[model samples]
Target: MDAFSNVDSNNRGKRIIDGYTPEPYHMPWIGLLVKDGKARCTAFLVSKNANAKASVWVLSAKHCFNDVLFDEYEDKTINSTSYGLLFGVHDLRFSTQHVIYRTIDELFIYPDEGLKTKDIILIKLDRQIKFNSYINGLCLPDSTEEHTPYEDTPW
Candidate 1:
């Protein structure tokens, strides 16, 4: 038997009970510049994590990635490059202070309708991340869960 088994198990239980969740592995915002169906410019957010890989999905206007080119370009199709999400920003400076995962991979995109501007996107990190400070993951709203808003209204 391992001498630390008892102590290790107790520590694991405490971690869970205290709601210790993984922090956001990626920056909150990312910017992409699409010109002639290719990404040219990029932007990133603050608060970086250094010990893991991050994945980011591009959220853009429907016309950005969709096959809706105007005029004579209507028939042309734009396919994503293999590197796709794995590419990193060129101008963004990455260091121990403002770094989140070393790289990004496995990217996916979802297009939203016109009314809602369905621009929201979610992407998973290529690998697990470790942070210098404690971090908490954001909670997404569930469709089936009951939610109550102020003024006796549920949204």
Candidate 2:
């Protein structure tokens, strides 16, 4: 909510109902998962320690890898042996100085014990990540508040 709050955007003469462009370093935890050369889903940077001076782990939803063993994808043309990660990506149009691309070395997936997206995949990068202003890990809070409708407020 600093300098980038409530900015308006136009999409090719179309009016956007709601849009958001993250400020630089505002959400260092966010990342993009790429299947082969195309983007697929979202990911989040995580750290084992609270301090998080240096972290090597990445987390992404397991559903994103549905086509993994089935032969890359249902198309049968694309063969996905592994997935890629793009971090610090504000815009996907072009690469920026703050942007980084990493190849995944291994994946630790925790499959559902009988639930949807009870799935989480842990990724290990080929190389270690160096923390900077534009790149950092997220330390989840001990607890989070449940969202309730603001029905009591006046419309």
Candidate 3:
């Protein structure tokens, strides 16, 4: 049996704070980072090549790959080949034609930042990901707006 087959999909009260199940395709930028075929962490598409309709970059929390976080593992660094991204799905347990998988090509964590600081990471895909109704990217804020507060920013 597949390791992922045992994944439990039931989540009656596991919403994010006050979040609820969003309509399909409403949050197409969300994705799952799969480590050795198992869901390891959540990520989001932050960039895309408009001309190619393909996403090239994704963002996730840095702790997802930190060695200290996985005390049971002996490896200090994660192997890129062992990871992939699963996109275009609201549910992770089910395999649908709409779900697209892409291998990870590279990982970029912010320099000089520890697990407790910044806590962000950016990933590059092995190949550009073609976008669809269920797969797309969210716009990253421009550098000029980096210091702007988001408390009043409209989503």
lDDT of 3 by residue, 1-155 (tens): 23234334443234355555566667888888766565677888876335447777889888878653443433323466567777877765566777777777777767645677888888888788778888888776667865766321001
TM-score of 3: 0.73
Best by lDDT: 3
Taking the tens digit of each residue's C-alpha lDDT, what string does model 1 give over 51-114?
3333233333443334433233343223322112212222222212423422233233453454
Ordering by TM-score? 3, 2, 1
The worst-scoring run of ten residues by lDDT in candidate 1 lies at: 2-11
lDDT assessment of candidate 3 = 0.67
How accurate locally, in lDDT, is each candidate?
A: 0.31, 0.62, 0.67
> Which portions of model 1 miss their true places by more than 4 Å?
1-98, 111-116, 131-135, 144-155
Q: Candidate 2, TM-score vs. the true structure?
A: 0.68
Instruction: Quote the positional error of residue 38 for candidate 2 in Å.
Output: 0.7
TM-score: which candidate is best?
Answer: 3
Model 2: runs farther than 4 Å from truth? 1-17, 70-82, 113-115, 143-155
User: Candidate 2 vs candidate 3: which has greater lDDT?
Assistant: 3
Best of the two (1, 3) by TM-score:
3
- For model 2, how does the per-residue alpha-carbon lDDT over 1-155 read when each residue is reduced to its tens digit? 11111112121232334544546567787877776456677788887766768667888877777656633334322232445677776766556677777767666766454328467777788776777788888775555756556311000
- Residue 17 of model 3, lDDT score: 58
